[model samples]
Target: MSTALLVIDMLNRYEHDDAGALAESVGESVPNIRRLLDAARQQDSTVVYVNDNHGEWTADRRELADWALQGSRPDLVEPILPSPDVPLLVKARHSAFYATQLDYFLRTHNVDRIVLTGQVTEQCILYSALDAYVRHFDVAVPSDAVAHIHKDLSDAALAMMERNMRARVCLTDELVGVFGSR
Candidate 1:
């Protein structure tokens, strides 16, 4: 089965109310995410980025990344920036698949399984996992690669993903093993 890595909502301005806490978690997860990106690319796994548009409807991937670079925590976003060649989908809501073309994109690419990584684990990551599950795609989420604003909620969310959604919740290295390496 072909696997695609979905990097969700990592591009942020950090101007929201709980930005500091979220940024802290994202800081810790960035290295793992970077490693996942490198490993996925090296292994020939498809890599796609799904981000919040921030209402910049006209902004392309480069423009979105550039705008995010101007945020307070550009350091966190820099290491995991989506490459120009990677497909970037902008979402308006918490779930990446909600009102987005992600499902169609994955279908077109023949991606039967997906590795989800990025911010707000309790929110976007969890919702995306459910959406993916309902779409009949096997979902895998690397715990170390997802950032969350609230630890307790994220823990519960992860549990739900594994239990209800049947997602594989593992560490970055373990997920890389599942993906296989060159």
Candidate 2:
């Protein structure tokens, strides 16, 4: 399968990214995200950062990030920036499928399966997975790599995805095998 790692809503925004929850386990997910990133590297898979483009009103995604960080919307999120190598996709709505070029990029890259990792599982993460499933992409969520408004809701979302959408709710440790490295 052509798998891609989708890091969603890890931007500096409260509505989607976990502003309050970061003091808890969100930092813990970073190492795993990094690990998953390395795994994707070995597998020659795509790494896409699906960020909330508070660009919902005006401007574009980069402008949104700049405004959120440099402007008065500091309460929404803290800066959890991605690496330079990671490709970014600005999502105007909850799901990454909302008027975004995610579909086009996936098609161009021949990405058939997606390994989703990001913040606010109850919202952006869940919505993205649902849309991916609907689009007939194999969806997998590494439980340790995502959190929700609360950890409880995170677990619940994962359960729902596994039971309803038939997604694989995996662990970061299990992600090692997906890499093509020998």
lDDT values for all models: 0.91, 0.75
Best candidate according to TM-score: 1
Model 1: colliding residue pairs = none
Q: Against the hidden reference, what TM-scores do the models get?
A: 0.96, 0.81
Backbone clashes for every candidate come to 0, 1
Model 2: per-residue lDDT, tens digit, 64-102? Answer: 556656643343334345556768878778898778899
As a whole number from 0 to 100, the lDDT of residue 106 in candidate 2 is 92
Write model 1 residue lDDT over 11-71, tens digit each, in one string: 9888899999999999889999999898888887888999999998999888999999998
How many times do residue backbones clash in model 2? 1
Off by over 4 Å in 1: 180-182
